[model samples]
Target: MKKLTYLFIALFSLSLLTTSCREEKTASEKVEEAIEDTGDAIEDAADDVEDEVEDITDDNK
Candidate 1:
């Protein structure tokens, strides 16, 4: 009876540990994705600024 109880406890712990380890996106991957997204946003903003500048310069000409 004690053996069965110990076996059940071990199985339960293993399942719990495995589930905890199964999350996607580790810290480094999340950081890298955020950096890439930020870079894209910055590039887009720069493009917008350049477009606005060109429009202003054209208007002034």
Candidate 2:
């Protein structure tokens, strides 16, 4: 009976550890997300600049 109890406890602890570890993102995943966000921001800024240039040219003409 004691051995069975120990086995159950060990399995429970292992499962909890694995579940907790999976909840957090890895370093590489975080860096990838940051890079993607930065790319999006740069694209948006470029679009805004293009619109401003077009407006300026239209006014000059």
Candidate 3:
């Protein structure tokens, strides 16, 4: 009976540890996401600037 109890406890702990180990994004994944976000923001700002320039040129003409 004692051995069965110990075996059950060990299996429960193992299952818990394995579940906790799953797919939390690593540091590199986080850094890549940040870089992609920064690139997107830069692209958006550039597009806004281009639109503004076009509007100004249109108004001047």
Candidate 4:
């Protein structure tokens, strides 16, 4: 029974240690995220410009 108690405590401690650790992003991951953000911004800007052009053409017609 004592050994069983110690085994339970050890497993609980191991689980706590593993769960508390965080994984950090690598440099390539950071670069990829930045590139994705920039692409999304550019795409949004293009959509806005396209909408403005459509509005202008509709008003002229």
- Give me the runs in candidate 3 sitting further than 4 Å from their true place: 1-22
Q: Candidate 1: deviation at residue 34, Å?
A: 0.2
lDDT (10s digit) by residue, model 1, range 25-60:
999999999999999999999999999999999999
Q: Which residue pairs of candidate 3 clash?
A: none
Residue 17 C-alpha lDDT in model 1: 82
Q: Give the clash count for model 4.
A: 0
Candidate 4 residue lDDT tens string, 1-61: 9999999999999998888657899999999999999999999999999999999999999
Largest lDDT belongs to which candidate?
A: 4
Report per-prediction Cα RMSD to one decimal: 5.7, 5.6, 4.8, 3.8
Query: Candidate 1 has what TM-score?
Result: 0.62
The models' CA-based lDDT, in order, is 0.96, 0.95, 0.96, 0.97
TM-score winner: 4
**Deviation (Å) of 58 in candidate 1:** 0.4
Candidate 3, after superposition: displacement of residue 38 in Å?
0.1
Q: Global CA lDDT of candidate 2, please?
A: 0.95
